[model samples]
Target chain A: MTLRTESRFADPDAAYRLLVEAHRKIDPEHGPALDAALVLLLANHIGDPAVLADAIAVAVKVVSPQRQ
Target chain B: MFQFAYRRSPDQDRSSPPRHDVVVVGAGPVGLTLAIDLAQRGRRVLLLDDADRIGEGSRAICFSKRALEVWDRLGVAAPMLAKGVQWQVGKVFLRDEQVYRFDLLAEPGHKMPAFINLQQYYAEAFLVARAGELPGIDLRWKNKVTAVADRGGHVAVTIDTPDGPYELEASHLVACDGARSPIRAMLGAAFIGETFEDQFLIADVKMRAEFPTERWFWFDPPFHTGQSALLHKQPDDVWRIDLQLGRDADPEVERRPERVRPRIERMLGHGDFEFEWISLYRFQCRRMERFVHGRVIFAGDSAHQVSPFGARGANSGVEDAENLAWKLDLTLSGGNAAALLGSYDAERVQAADDNILNSTRATDFIAPHSEYERMLRNVALGLARGHEVGKRMVNAGRLSQPSLYASPLSTPDHDAWDAGPPPGAHLRDVPLGDGFLTDAFRAAGCRFTVLRDGAGPEVPGAAVIDAAASPLFAARYGTRPGDAYLLRPDGYVAGRFRAAAAGAIPAALHRARGAA
Candidate 1:
């Protein structure tokens, strides 16, 4: 919520909750693929490649914390 | 000479002059509604119009949920409902093909009533006659406001009666005069706006065949130089038809049936139909630069004039009076300051803007800018039928009667969010159980309702405005479960949040308290 990541949202909301809702439709385990897809889709909307990279890095770090 | 009173306090003798807390300049829908709304609140009111007989012109045939709510508040909606036709579907004709249609019933019911097909004359006549019977209400026809001058603390209005020019004084003045509002122009207020170059012909006709009881528009006239025609069906096989006047077409020529008959035959497929009335209109999308200045306020076509396409022009004006009426009462009764009056412009300007957009959009499609515009609109209408999103978007355009009064000046809430409006700024959902948000506020008799979802944040001043997921409310507003929005006493969505907006309730209260 600190720096703007995307415009898919009217405003940033609890991302985990959105992911949970998006995942509830297809998968239960809350797959990393959906998280990655959401990050890339929102990243593309964020427009600036540098901003996208940063948000993606943060999102990846959040979803795949072992990489941290 | 003017006499002010709290109610229908009877005169002691012939020496006692007639008393009125407010004297409305006209007995049109807005004027009569204003008088009744005030009189119902126990304020003595006298309504006057220059016309000798009751209103006869069926000028505005479309009534919004906002208007219905006002009628309900006056306890007159049930009778109107018995006579009025609730239109739930909209059909558009791109030549022979039915290209665009919106099922208003597709949305669930809420507090709002679905759009009704009733003549403005009927509404005005009903309310005026009914309000006349009410104590402290005197509807004097043939009495016109000749001139008005502000006398410092009070307003002096001159009425040119058949007897003579009688002088009257009141606290405030409202100009609801039609396009040619003498009071607005007399006050030297600028009605800054544009007039559409395109002129059109409108006729009320009686046809033996049954046309669908919804408004139907023709984008491109199938015959004679490519103008368009719009048709609205009434109860007794009466259809109001509007034929667009093309760019090079002479409006003077088509002012009567002789020149217009062929085009009507070409577009509606019958010039043989019986004609009740025929007239030509040049749509002027204009508004007063200021709704309020000094003590005189403008309402109805006097303040803003939009095309008849979406029927928001006069309806919004009704809302203007409704909003101003309550605030006027409060201020006159020492409940609020005159600063609250500024919101009349704030909200009504936005409402006028809304009507302008909807009207221009509809007219733009019907009267295409170019061949490309015509083709694009035709194709969009073609696509609009098959695609649900397109249909919903099209439907959204049809129901575009939003009023934005979320300012610190006149809004109900003491709190306002400077950050900007919430997510549903562009989203329009009809009210539930309450009826159309416009009419519900009107029907509530301008009482503040706290709109909530059973348990939510409670604002100190407002009426609790909650949704019951009520089928009735949803039917008119297209609102769903867990949805709630608070409206102004005049029926504009003051602030709404799905789930909840960060500072909505407080923002509403701040605006309300500031207005109060």
Candidate 2:
């Protein structure tokens, strides 16, 4: 089955709080490595190449809006 | 809390060494259980341990259903259930938000609960008292094994006591010693596996609190930042708190009350608890290459060890006791020693590997080796907060269960059927008569049992039990009137037949007994 992109949590703030808490203890230089690892883990957990590609495209578009 | 005074035995004064049918080293849960099982089977057992009392601490508080079943067969599950805190619900939280909760025992009608939290000392105490009731068991305290020599037919053991040293010969020697087994060390067997560097502080606190008897786990909670924590309720109004204290935390400093009390106070939001026991441990997943070395056999932590995450250590060890007990009994009763004892090594090794694999995965998730791995773990936890997949992926600990042995002794089924326990799987407890199926199995003595739906052709040389009155039995067994099941003495399904044909029953029983 493909990954669910829409919000599944009952409380969205609770979901957001978990993400913020994950990075509160790490150094700044380790941020990209952490984000990359997160992407890989989430990608595997999602387990669909098509869904991961879609996620990567949306992330790239948000990062470089002018290029799109 | 249980203590026994050491007394001199006749063996110490004998000019020649006395020989025994079975000798079990160490008096922990595994050793005591093994000795009791053998004694119940009418075998004389010499049980020795170095200590004069049950070990201090509330170690191994979680007892699974399989473990309770084993204790039930040994006649000690009643008191343990009475004193233990039984629960099925477990909750996991990510920081301040709870990710999800689960019920371990979803169905009813079973005799035992999903899990019970009882101190290790209580389990050992019950087992020791039961051993005292059996005349076949010779339990000696403060008696240490000074040396062991396997001389082909029998094993020679030298013991040292407070009085003096003595010698004895045993047809079978079982090492139920803890992780650092002196017998294993003397044999020079290599215990090979990986060791996780992360440390955990276990504190048993006694307090009167309103917390439910459920397991609670936190991943990076506000009280314990950047680590994991677990809390569970035990008997005597005591709670067990395990906090992950990174790889570099000094165990000597962390075990002190001043250091442990504050961490617990912050987590509980009060300082009303008193410490009953405090200890530190790191995860080690290791096992001997072979559990059976000639006449000497190894069970429990001496044979294998897993991380404390899954509660597999003592639980699996107890299983080993049951598994080995029957095989040893058969071997002593003139059964094929090579074939029967060989299956014990094969089956228990498979179980140990399964336990090690599960505990290793949980340990890796709990204590990630690198920052990159930590990020992956955090991401999994974050997704768990909102996603069903994340909840399934989180690894607090994969709770212990009985191993369905892929044993050489199991007779493969040729019939196409559904329901009931398959061959080599443990029997599920179902209500029958005034008691349960497990109690009925116990009543059949330590021999193969034939369970049939109704009156069927009697199978020769096997205890027969009729399940005609109980519909649950027919439903659980997926059987009609003539169907039958053959159960091993250790309560595992050996074979099942579509019809209660007496001709085919003997062959299945022969195979189950490892008779060539």
User: Each model's TM-score, in the order given?
Assistant: 0.73, 0.90
B1-516, model 1: which lDDT tens digit per residue? 121222221231224333345667776777777887777777777676776655444488888866776667677788677777778777766556675676655545334456787766667767866786788676666677888887677677777766555666767776776778888867888877666767778888777765667777665646634667677876557778787776666767777677766766765676668777788887777787778776777788888887787777667767777777777776677755555677666767777877776676666555655444454444444444444323332321355354555565433323333332332231234455535543444444456554544456665566665555444443333344444555555544556555445246656545654444
Error of 2 at B398 (Å): 0.6
Model 2 residue B55 CA deviation in Å? 0.8
In candidate 2, how many Å is residue B8 off? 0.6
lDDT of 1 at A13: 20
* Model 2 TM-score (B-chain only): 0.98
lDDT of 2 by residue, B278-372 (tens): 99999899999999999999999999999998889999999999999989998999999888989999999999998997787778778976665
Q: Which ten-residue region of model 2 chain B has the weakest summed lDDT?
A: B381-390
Which candidate achieves the best TM-score against the true structure?
Answer: 2
- B415 Cα displacement, candidate 1 (Å): 13
